[model samples]
Target chain A: MAPNGVNGSSGSHRFDPDFTRLVVENMGPNVAPRTRQLLGGLIRHIHDFAREVELTNDEWMAGVHFINSIGQCSTSIRNEAHRVSDILGLESLVDEIAHKLVVEGDVEPTSSSILGPFWSPNAPFRDLGSSIIQDPNPKGRVALMHGTITDLLTGKPIPGAVFDIWQASANGKYDFQDPENQTPNNLRGKFRADENGKYWFYCYHPTAYSLPTDGPAYKLLQLMERHPMRPAHIHIMVTHPDYRGCTTQLYPKDDPWLATDTVFAVKNDLVVDFKPKEGDPKATLDLEYNVILPPKDYKGKL
Target chain B: MAPNGVNGSSGSHRFDPDFTRLVVENMGPNVAPRTRQLLGGLIRHIHDFAREVELTNDEWMAGVHFINSIGQCSTSIRNEAHRVSDILGLESLVDEIAHKLVVEGDVEPTSSSILGPFWSPNAPFRDLGSSIIQDPNPKGRVALMHGTITDLLTGKPIPGAVFDIWQASANGKYDFQDPENQTPNNLRGKFRADENGKYWFYCYHPTAYSLPTDGPAYKLLQLMERHPMRPAHIHIMVTHPDYRGCTTQLYPKDDPWLATDTVFAVKNDLVVDFKPKEGDPKATLDLEYNVILPPKDYKGKL
Candidate 1:
C-alpha cells in the first residue's frame, strides 16, 4: 500500500481484476480511517485513469516525470504543485465545496476563497489606517481599505481580530515575486481590528498579472492552450481565538478574465468597488467592507 | 490555466458551479483531442477527489509539498513516481488493459509486465551462453537462462531478435541501485537470438530485496504499513523489426513475494523454475523459456 511498493501476491500469481480490491483492502488496520479513505480513493481513481486510456509504459513514464517536475518547480514562496491544482480546477472546486459546508445554517458567514501562493506569513505588523506601502516611491494610486469583523450569528463586533494583508503593486508583482525592483513586504502587512472591531490600511491599487510562465506548470497551460491571467485582487486573512479563521481575496470590479479565472477564486460577495477618493491627501481611493466571522467550535464549512 | 495562476474575471465577481464547465470549455481549440481527453479527465477526477474528501487548506498544502518531495526523490535511475504508480496498482491495471487489447484474436503473444525503473539501455552485449556475471566470482548459484523466439501465430523461429536482460545481484541490488557494492553492468547484458531463434545466458541467481527505504516512496509504504520486499525477478525485454516488442519480468518459482510482487508484475507463464544441474561446472542451474513474438504490425494486446 506504500507508494513505492506494489501488488497483493503472497508469493504466487495475482489476478488483474482482483488487484484493485486487494490493493485497497490490504491496507493495514493501523492506517487511520481518513488516510485509508483518501488513499483508497486515490488508488481507485488512478487505476481508472490508466485503464480508461489503456496507458502504456511510455505514457506512465511521462506522468511520473511530470509529477516530479511539478515538485521540483515548487519553493517556499512559489508552489508549483498548487499551480497544478489550480490549473486542474481542483483548488477551485475545493474552495466552493468547503464554503457550502459552512453555509449550512441560516446564518451564512462570508464565503471563503483560496489564500493563493503569494501570501506572506511574515508581513510587517502595522497600526490601524496605516499604509502597507514599504517603498518610498511606489506605483499606482493610493487605495484605502477598511473593514470590520463581527460574529455571523450574533452580529457583534469581535475585537483584536488578526488580519494578514497582501497585494501586488501596480506593476503586477508581489514583493518576493519582483525582488530586484520591489522592497521585501512592499504593499504587504499584518493588522488587527481595534476595540471597535475596525481595521484599516492603505496600499497601491492592484492590476491583472500573468502567472509565472517559466516552469512545468506553465507547460501544462500551453498544452491545454489556456491563457494564464488572474484579475486584480487583494488577499485578506482574519483570525481570532473565538472565531473560525478565514482566508479570502477581494476582487476589484473591473478586470478581465473574471469568468475565466484559472483558479476559480471569485465570488459575487467578495467583489467590491475601489472608488476614486477626493478630499484626503493621504488617500486617492477608498473602500470599506466587513467580515462575518463564524464561531471557532462551529463544525461548519470550509 | 497555468499552475501558478488563478480565476477568471473581467475584473468582477464570479459565480460558483459554472467554474468547471468554463474552465474546461475555455481550453483552446489547439489542444490535441487525446491531450484534451486525458487532461480533461484528469481535471474532473482531481476535482471530484478533492470534493469527495471535502479537502482542507492544510490538506491541500500538504499534498503540494508531498508532490514536490516525490519529484525531489526521483533521479534518472530511480523513479519514485513509477514506484507510487506501482503502489496504487495503476501499473498493474494498465498492464492488464493493454494486454487485453492484444488478445483480441485466438493467437496471443506473451503477457507484458512493467518495465520497472531499474532498466539500463546501455548494457554490454553478450554471446549466447555467456555469463552476465562480470566479477571473477559472484554470490548465489549460477542461473542458466535460455529462450527461443517464435511467432505466436506461425510458431516459426524469428532469428536476430534482440533482448535486453537485467536482474538484481545476489544482494538484491541493481548495479545503479547499489553503486558502491556492485560493479557496473554486473549481472546485466544484451543479446540476440541465434539463427535458430534461441538465446542463452548465465548470471548469479537473484534474491528478494527491499525497495529504497530512504525517500518519499518509502514513506508511503510506511504509511500503508506495507513491507518493501519484492519477489526476485529477471527483467527481460525482446524486440525485433518484424515483431511487436515486449518488456516483462520472469519470476523465479518459489520466491515468497510472487503473488504480492510490490509492483504486481508476476504472471503465471512468466514464472519459471531454476532447477539444479549437476553435470558441468558451468551449468549449476538451468532455465528455458520460449518467447512468442507477435508481428510488428500486430494490433494485439500488451
Candidate 2:
C-alpha cells in the first residue's frame, strides 16, 4: 500500500484494521482534520508497498542499514547521500507532482532539488560578465552565456530574476566536494538580471563527466546496471517574486552522455548549441537565450 | 511511491521511462539480483493498489501527517498510540505474518506489540499468591487463580516460568492511565512458579471497559461508527527457556464484550473460568490449575 493507499489494492493480507488504528491514535490532539485524512492515506500507501513486496526480514534490515549508511556518508562539506536523493529525482517528483495538484493562488514555496554532497550554500555572488574560474584545471574554450527571463503569458521582461548557477570544474569536481580543487568559489556564482531582464556570464565550457563513484548513489547505479555519466552542463535555479521558480540544466550539442544521463535531467528545451562566432574571440564566445517563465497567476509551487 | 516507489501504476498513466529511472535510482546500493526481482514484483502490486483507489493529493498529505503524528505521540510512559495501533490489528497482523518467515536457529527476541504507553520498565516483582490490593476499589467476588506451566509437547512441568500480570482494578481502571483512580504501580506484579510450576493468587474479577476516548482513536471511532469496548480480562506475559515466550490475555466466560473487543485480543484457547469455592472462607483456599505451553521446539525466542 505504498503512500497512495486509496488506489493501492495489494497488501490486504497485511492490512490489519490496526494500521488505521495506529495512524489515527498516534495522530495526537492538535492535528487538523485535513492532515489526519492525508496521513491515513499515506499509511495505506506505505503499508501497501511493504505488503506488495511481501517484504522480508532481511530486506527490511537492509533498508535500515541503507538509510544508516546514508547518514554516515553525509559530512560537513559533502552530502553524497543528498545528491543520491536528487539524482533519483525524488525531490523533483515530490515537488512537481504535489504542485500540479495545488490550485491557483495558494501554492506553497517550491523547494527545488538540493543536490547533496556537491553544493555550497555560501558561493559568492558575481556581476554579469565576470569570470567564474576557481583554480588551475585546464580551462576550455570560453563561453559567454546571455539569457532573458520573461513572463510566459505576456512575454514581459522580469527584471531582477536571480540566477544561481554552478558547474563542475574541468575535472568534474566541485569546490566544496573536492579538496583538490583550489578555487574558493570554483565555477559557482549568483547573478541578478538587469532592468531589462538580461544577463551574461563568462566561464569555461564544461566537460561531460561521471558523478563520484565512491558514494552510495554510485553503488546504486552499478546495482541497477545504469551509467553514472551526466552531460556537460551548467546547473541553474532561476527565480523571481511574481513567477514560478525553475531549476534546470543547459547541455551543449552532441554530448555523448546527453541521451543517457544517469539523472534523467535532460529535457529537449534545455539543449542548446553554443554556436561558435566567426573570427574574433569575443564573437566566438557569445550566446543568447530566452526562457519563458510561468506567470504569477499560474501559481504552481511545492 | 510510498516508501518503496510502488505507486507508479496507481496513476492514470502507465509507467514511463521516468518510472524505470526512479526504480533504478531509488533502490539502495548492493541490492542483490534476487532482491531486485522481488522488489519489482512488490512495486507492481503497490502500484496496482494505488490505481485501484485513485488516491488524491489531500489524502496523501493526510497519510504523511498521520505517520509523523505517530512519531510525535510516542514517548516512554504512555503508548496510547500503540493501543490505537493494536486496535488497527496491524501489530498482530505483522507479527503473525512474519512469524513463519523466521529461519530456524535465527529467531529474534520475542517481538512484542508496540509497547503500550503505560509500561514503566520497573514493575515490582512479588511472591506467588500475593494480592494486588494496595488500594482496592469497588471490589467484586474473590477468586483463587492457580496455574501450573508445562511444555505442550512433553507435558513436563517447567520449574521456573515467570509470570508478569496486570489488570484493571475491580472497577475497570489501570493505575497508571487512570488519573482519577489511584497512584502508579498499584495493580501490577511479577511472580515465578515454584519447582512444580505451580502458583496461586487472590484477586477480584476484572470488568471489561473502553479505552480512552479523549484522543485521536476516539475521533476515529466516531468516524468509523465503532465502539471502544474490550472483554473482561487480565494481561499475562509468560517466559521460560525451553519454549517461546507468550503474551496473552485470560478472558472470563459470559463477558459481553469478548467477541467484539476493540483490541481484538481474544482467542478461544485463552478463555478461563473462575470456580467459586463455597465453604469456610479460609478452607479450600488452594485451587488446582494447569497451563499448556506451546511446543518445546517452537523457535520463537532468541
lDDT of 1 by residue, A1-302 (tens): 11111221211122255667777776777998888877876776566556545567677778888998887777767788888888777776767765554356686687788878778778888988899887744558788888899998788999999988888888888888788878888888888899989998887677788888999888998999987888888888899999888889888888787776777778888888889899989988988889988888776543
lDDT of 1 by residue, B1-302 (tens): 11111221111122244555666787898899888877766665565456555677677778778888898787776678878878777777776765654355685687888877778878998898799887534566787888799998788999999978998878787788677777999888999999989898887667789888898877888888787888988888899998888888888899888876766778788888888877868868888888888887766443
True contacts kept of 2: 0.08
Q: What are the lDDT figures for the candidates, one per model?
A: 0.76, 0.60
Q: Write the residue-wise lDDT of candidate 2 on A158-253 in tens digits.
A: 899988788887777777656766567888888899999998887767778887788766776676666788788877788888887776677887
* Cα lDDT over the full model 1: 0.76
Query: Distance from true position, residue B57, model 1, in Å?
Result: 2.3
At residue A3, candidate 2 shows an lDDT of 41
B1-302 per-residue lDDT for model 2 (tens digits):
33333344434442233554354445556678676755554445433333334444444434434433343444455354455555654444444445432433432333233223344466678888787556667555556677888765566788888877777787777887676776676777777889998877766567788877765566555554457887888766777877676665677877987766676566565667766587636322333446656554765432
Error of 2 at A259 (Å): 4.8
Which stretches of model 2 miss by more than 4 angstroms?
A1-18, A76-81, A98-125, A134-136, A139-141, A156-160, A178-180, A192-197, A208-230, A256-262, A276-288, A299-302, B1-8, B13-34, B37-93, B100-302
